[model samples]
Target: MTRRHFRLLIPVFLVAILGGVVWFQLRSPSAETIAAWVDQAEIALSNQQWKESERLAQLIADSGDREAAQLIAGETAYFEGNLESAFQTLGQIPLESRWRPRASLLAGYAAFRLQQPYLAEQLLTEAIESYPKEVDAFRVLSVIHYDQGNLRVAIEDLQQVATLAPEDARPWRQLGLIHRDFERFPEAEQAYAQAVQRKLPPVLEAEVRQEWADVLVRLARHPEAEAILDAIPPEVPMTAERMTTALAIAQVTQSPEQLDAQLAQAVKQFPRHAPILRANGVRALQRNDPESAVKWLKTATQVDPYDYRNYYELAQAYQRANNATAAKEAESEVKRLQALLTRLTELSEAAMDQPWDAAVRRELATLCRSLGKMELAKQWEIAASRCEQAR
Candidate 1:
């Protein structure tokens, strides 16, 4: 109540205000400090220190660096395999922002992993334009081209990737797979050899060797195939593909009695592998045992309904067993699947090139629906709408 007491209170109030101001200033980092934190976050991300990056993301967000927070969060989502979240977060970054190129690159990969190839191609193209030396974008683009059945363009993309990263064996291994799938045996062999020369990890080396052996078997280089198989360590597990390749070589090199034992062992080891069951069906058919062939082939079809070859073999087995109705049904499936594959290949090529073509996307959606790829069908339907809007 006294005037002196009032004056003392006034000074205390002013000091309290000054102290509050000082605390606020200390808590709120400067723009430059926020930028430095963003840089540190980026470094943590590049080094794959995910927890550190996440910590920085929270710090950056607290400091009002929303875009930098989004970048870190997007990358974390991507590494965590939350692809849609990654794409959404990364895609929200402004195109003109300095961080956009990195965002686009990661978002592009997320789109590709989500099977939105058209969107992936668009974002990857933008990323490539901004950062021409980025090898991962080119590698993913190559796979997209391969999915389109544009093998030449895919090869070109891979060649660019190889030029950018010569020590990476993955491109050579991928090239081998493509050639093997297309039945270009000699090219597959050469690519596999190149991959081997690059000194792959033990597991990958064994896989590559098995594939190379399969290619050799296709080329009738039985001795070489056998040698390649022999080179694989006994400790490695026998995968279905490896088992199939061994069987192929056995059929060529072993006596009938030995092959019978091999087939029985393969079936025992990989009881549910469709290729092994199909092999058994083919062997039974060769021996004129239609009932056994029908049993094995039917199982193969059940195991892998998408493989047309199973149905094709089943049709033969059914026909030989005098099951005309079942034979016709299997044959019909073969024809349907074959036609679906042909049309899908064509439309995929078209869609890859004409990303704005709503008609192509709709057709793809319909095809996917018929093939029981319901998830892919839904994606294609959504993409079709985007295509229409883009147009």
Candidate 2:
């Protein structure tokens, strides 16, 4: 070969060698290097540096660190609201791996977030069986059952959690909520009392106290309810809800003149409040002042047009006043509203099977408007609107 040709070949050979070195550096990292990367990713996650953590986690996964990589990737996807990806990623973790139980728990959570309660139940049950000590998995399984309308099963799951973690106030609180939902006031009161005895955050403690007071009122133990309400610290301002509870206590415990004074104060404080207005209307009816009842109830219907109870009360007032025409009209409205509520409930159940259906959401909004659930109606309307916009 000529000298000039040889020089050119040497330069090309050197370039190839450099390219090979670069490729080697970019290949799958060693086990030690991947472990170090995993540590860095965990630190980034702890610091809430999500983007850096995601990048590092992806790098580790690509380097063949499947167990830690999939776990971190799934968790990152969950935090980022990528539910399907999170579920799929976490499901890839082998059952033999130490991370499997946690992966199953997270995957179940992702399924629940996706509104697949049945799948969540399945996954969570498996996780519970695999790691009987996982309190969080049991808790989430209970919530899934509750959301699916399996109240009995939900209660049973919570009982298991209580047995497993007796010191945890959350299980007791959940039991109280379930009892309250079923209107088992005595059971609710007992559960809430137990929860109150345990360690709880201040806000949660206040909520439990309020709910317990409500149960006391239901049992007609007015003095007990009042004591519970009075114990709430001054730092927790008397919200409209607390005011309503206070009014209930006064209604049961106070004399006529004192009740009137309390009602007047409530009206002055919460002018235009629907519950207070409804209370006044009911009181007028009980006093046999049909004319006054009609007047107050009419105003309430105007202020909160969707409450079926107000229409029913208005009908009774009209009947008492011998206004047959007005009574018939109000009664008809009550029946119509009741029928609409029933239809909406059926639609809501059906929609649960097809949660992304915009038509169902729109129908729900219409029904909610007729049932005095105005805020929920607005939410349904917004969801329908978003679906339409996406389309």
Candidate 3:
């Protein structure tokens, strides 16, 4: 209770108050600082820098902005193909939060990717309720309906997306794919034409053109398809499908010399490509060179035994070479492969009808593997895994 003790206590109180102020300043980030961090995170996300965006999201989370942080984290995970983590993180964002609409859309997309079509449909419906003009939601909903075999509903959803984003070619491209898969060649050609008219990245434009050309070929518009194919830039890398399409067009529309030159180029570029090898063999057979035809046809069969067309062509080459027994054996092989291909088509239709059936998807993977479609086999395997998880 002395005057000196009172004076020491006052300084102690002042030091304690000053320390509290400093601690508060250190603990709470300014609103402007948080906004800046958010901007940087979004920029990183737009640029596809997933790790950097996640790091910034963590910083934002530490600063007590959990919703924005969650959205950033979810988006990064989604872009990185971590759909489960994306769905969980995005679903945690509250409906009242400013980030809710975007979160819901992404979460719905994640669910769809995970093969939970029913849940994804509900979530997307909710998101569209919140953001009526959500093009991405509508686009994904179209895909979900397509997978579920609701073709009419899928087209309706895609039309809505196309209406919402008139300048985007992706919706039309999707429409084209749907029609193409159903063998509606005219509708596919029209949709692909629309897609090609819109703005697209160069690579995507080339791909779209290629797809359009394929549809044109199916429609027997050989001249138009050849013109479209010729318009594509030479620098674009030719995928197997692209080369196959080119060969198909060349065989029908080009002179024999031109067809031969194109086949040579294709065979040089893809020495082990089964389709090109078969085309070469067929050309040789047409020229009455049975020995060369037999050699190329045998190579084609070895390269891809599952393609019944190769076996059929080999049978023809064997007959031309007067090998009756070999021709009969090749014919039998063709019949067996054609039966397998028919079964594959039937199973694919079954899969589209029963989206929740993991067994159908697993069978598809097995069949695709047996047919030498390793990439498609992997995709079917992944789809089966996702289907199982959804169940």
Each candidate's TM vs. the true structure? 0.62, 0.66, 0.69
Per-model C-alpha lDDT, please? Answer: 0.87, 0.80, 0.86
**Stretches of candidate 3 exceeding 4 Å from the true structure:** 1-118, 129-132, 142-156, 235-241
TM-score for candidate 2: 0.66
List candidate 2 segments past 4 Å from native: 1-89, 94-102, 109-120, 142-153, 161-171, 199-204, 286-288, 340-366, 374-391
Please give, for residues 1-391, the per-residue lDDT of candidate 1 as tens digits: 9999999899899999999999978898888887788778878877889888878888888977677778888988887778999999999999888778889999999998887877888899899988899998999999776655456678778878978998888888989987887678999999898888887888889999999999999899998999998998898887988999999999889987888889999999999999899989989998899999999999999998988999999999999999999999999999999999889778877875775678888999999888767887887787787666544
Query: So what's the TM-score on candidate 3?
Result: 0.69
Q: Which ten residues in a row have the lowest lDDT in candidate 2?
A: 382-391
Where is the poorest 10-residue window by lDDT in model 3?
144-153
lDDT of 2 at 96: 89
**Candidate 1 at residue 214, lDDT?**
91
